[model samples]
Target: MNQLPTAPPVATAQVPPHLVDSTSRYVESGLRGAANTVRAYAGDWKRFNAWCTLNHLSALPASVEALAGFLTELADAGKKVATIQRHAAAITKAHELAGHDSPTADKKIKVLLKGIAREKKTRIKQAAAFTLATFKRTIQSMDVTTPTGLRNRALLLLGFTGAFRRSELEALNLEDLAFDEEGLIISLGKSKTNQLGQAEEKAIFYSPDSAVCPIRSLQAWLRVLGRTEGPIFVSLRKNQQLTARRMTTKYINLITQQYLGSGYTAHSLRASFVTVSKLNGADDSKVMNQTKHKTSAMIRRYTRLDNVRQHNSAKELGL
Candidate 1:
């Protein structure tokens, strides 16, 4: 009988050190992911590494079972489901890059997303829409005689009139503003955009007319404040010199909180602008274009039909 020959012993495989280093460098340089996204993933990976180290487990080249265990640990520690999902997402992305498939990726992501939705439903208090009347009240309540107060008022007007996000407002430089025959044009450098999620790199121009109330308020503010150059809004110290330093997102939040009390957030200003423009018969597509919103779904989040306009429409329709 022709019996099968004895099977040869398997040899241990070894990957070269230089090959590993080269592969890492290639990933660091040439990965198609955005820089910010990579940074976030790196941060997540570090946290995972730390957790695994504390528990005497290996974090590198994590397996589906290890990931599931980690998520279970997170759940036990009362960590938010969103946070767990983020960690899972980072691991999944890393594994995909390493040409490996993760069995838990879809399941973990789905569970986390469901948890996020449930949490959101529990916190369903949306921001109340801002109105022209409420805006005037807020401005009037401010003690604009003080330099800081005056600057804040101007900032508020700019934020509302230009539909500026906190980041966009903070990034504005004095050179970005242009005085032309049409009106005042403030150049916006960055804001949240659907096209890129956030931090869009292009500059957009926002025009505020002297004839309009919001624009007129801004013009009056610019005239009273005498701030035409340098960083448009500088931090005002007790000495009253406009510091070379720029304003921050936190300052925007504080200022809005101070003026509007609890329900009025800085983002409400931008939303109000979009809502008012839509109620005034401005085209949604044009408004979306100006706001740099790539989708109608997101534009709806920022734009709502004005209550007064809705009432008037109802009356006209005999409803």
Candidate 2:
């Protein structure tokens, strides 16, 4: 009697054509989320397929045992729970699309997640609330005699005035800024104001004409630097000639480290700006526009006014 032959291993690229077409459509939706999300899911699925092939597991759709094995391997590799969960989600989505009800869908996923716990660590406090009253004095102490010093002073002024993220400050182009009769209109494509979750993409706008006079210093630096176009912040050599390239985020970090030490960050100016604005009674809508925040929740974190205002009121009443 002839023995039955073992089934050949399935090819990943042999996935149903309709599923591939649907995934393609999902990726090209033009939404910002679609691009990253679809790419991540597709990549995770490919990795899972490879793992299944190596383990000699039948990469059958919805196989809870195979999924459990995959999770075990991920844990052995020291993958974080969040990372494993993301991979599991992608696998489940793919399996469902292939018309195979995922055996690991709800039950096995819950069990796997239970094994992958969140890391426990102290959360670092934001540097915003620790406003040293001597920040201005520190700036005054900085030497402005040299070309590099002058540029550093200008950078400091812009950071405080514009509340720019280091990346946004680095990305600044000469064409993005306009010096008008009122003040400077900086076209900030990205900013600390945008935060991590804002949906709208409006650029942050900063004008030097505010009560702060240091905005003029930025203008002076711009004029003296002789940069009429291209990047607004250019690297300067020892000879004081402007380098064609722009400054980088790492350079900004270095400036912060050298000037303000450990507690200070590029984000400090942003927080300080928000605190100052709220203290001056600037409305949420105006602050929102300046910060380019789609919502008010993020701005609220920087405006810790309840206790500060109450303390001042008690002082006024001599209580």
Candidate 3:
């Protein structure tokens, strides 16, 4: 009787006890946020660790003075107040994960941050919203005859209509799309707000005009893709050949900049959705329904320009 040969057993490498514990805690902490957030926190922690090492200071149980010195160095290097604050938060989170008290919680650190905020007069830059006219112009400018063009057109339309964050857009897969007579439905497995992996759906209705319809654009792109699985948007080689990889969030920002010029980011599509919806007379709650904004305050911030002009008391006074 003939028998198949047995394969050799694979050997597993043993991790050090300290490394095992540290890795477990780091992973557990990372699981609490979205992937991008985890990456940002990891980078922030690495920078802090590097700083502590260079200055011969303790990082795991960092002192308030050391943390304050790090912030001071960041400010001296022209880091924004928001960037410094986020770094502080990352440091705090890292220490807590290691079972130590966060130095960022000290009164001195808080006061230092406040003083930095008061010292810096830099304004936070917001992405420019795409109005209806600008949206139409941008869409029309895309030549959908080529493969990349088709993909960009579809990406832009879906992003604007769905009001999806850059991460959400890049996370979309072919399985997430559902098409029907009404329009297209996108099933988001996870998002910034839904870190529990809860399923959520966003609808994009068909437009009367085929040229500006997101559904039509998506269909055209899919036809070019010729696949029923994998990511919806993919990386294109220099020759315009589609790769079997998902697009990065940075690419989304670049695409927006390509169409709308500089200062526009991937968030422009989402902000545009909220701004245009309000300008078209949609209420805050209605816009919030589409945007999935957690608070009315955020929705208000998006529509502030429209509100200031529409609800201006000056219009009521006989000027």
- Runs off by more than 4 Å, candidate 3: 1-31, 304-319
lDDT of 1 by residue, 84-196 (tens): 66677776666555555654555764674566547545433345567777777777677766667768877887777677777777777767766655556665543444323
Better of 2 and 3 by TM-score: 3
Q: List the residue pairs that clash in candidate 3.
A: none
Q: Which is the leading candidate under TM-score? A: 3
Worst 10 residues of 2 by lDDT: 1-10
lDDT of each: 0.64, 0.63, 0.82
**Model 3, residue 202: C-alpha shift (Å):** 0.4
Candidate 1 colliding pairs, count: 0
| lDDT of each residue in 1-319, candidate 2, tens digit only | 0111122323439667558655544433322233235567777777888888888776556378888888778877877666777788777656544546665656756766675553422233465432434456667777877767777877876776566667777877777766655567775553443433334322333334432245565666677678677886778887877788788877886786677777777767667777777777788887776656557888887664445552265666765
- The TM-score measured for candidate 1 stands at 0.66
Give lDDT: candidate 3, residue 77. Answer: 96
Worst 10 residues of 1 by lDDT: 1-10
